[model samples]
Target: MAQEPDPERLRALEARLAEAKGSKAKPAAAGKDFSQAEVAWRMVLELTSGIMIGGSIGYGLDYLFGTRPILLIVFLLFGFAAGIRTVMGTARDMQERQLRAQAIETQAEHSAGTEG
Candidate 1:
């Protein structure tokens, strides 16, 4: 069982939401905000999960087919591929973020030069 929503509270919430939507708030985070520390953390998670999933799949395949090492080897390779994919994607995202910041800085400098 759930509690019923209050009409007044709902209206107040709606009004607050409308005001928030109308306000111009700066984005708190962008792709560029991912630091080396953050990337490293994410990489760890990615590699761990990739290895776990790959190992599980390989182990399962091996068990099912009565193959000794083929599945494990193949799955480890798959996990490596996944890690590379994550690294590439993260690098690309960081590059894009850097470009965005550079573009913004360039625009600011141009405007300042023109004005002064």
Candidate 2:
């Protein structure tokens, strides 16, 4: 005949299952944390790429027009302006994100304070 399961063993299994589920329910915090260095690097890359792309386009135009230094100089300045604009945009985005994060943290704290 088949035997019945023991009550103690069933409780132990349920406890372990609940513990595992609880652990998994917590959000993964590792990916969200961006260090200052990483943020700076991201901004720097954005600016650099903008400048490089602008400079390349300018260089190509100068070569096509046979204007030599004139177009090159103009384009280089344009590229610098474009890069500054991109960097400013990146800074604004980062600021907005930081504000939102702070708001969330503040809300969470307020809720916790109210609960206790």
Worst-scoring 10-residue span by lDDT in model 1: 23-32
Q: Residues 62-107, candidate 2: write the lDDT tens digits.
A: 8898887787778778888888888899789778888988998899
The TM-scores, one per candidate, come to 0.67, 0.69
Tell me each candidate's RMSD, in Å, in order.
Answer: 7.0, 8.3
Give me the runs in candidate 1 sitting further than 4 Å from their true place: 1-32
lDDT of 1: 0.82
- Across 63-105, the per-residue lDDT of candidate 1 in tens digits comes to 9999968998899889878977887787787788789899987
Q: Which ten residues in a row have the lowest lDDT in candidate 2?
A: 23-32
- Cα misplacement distance, residue 89 of candidate 2 (Å): 1.3
Q: Please report how far candidate 1 places residue 115 from its true position, in Å.
A: 1.4
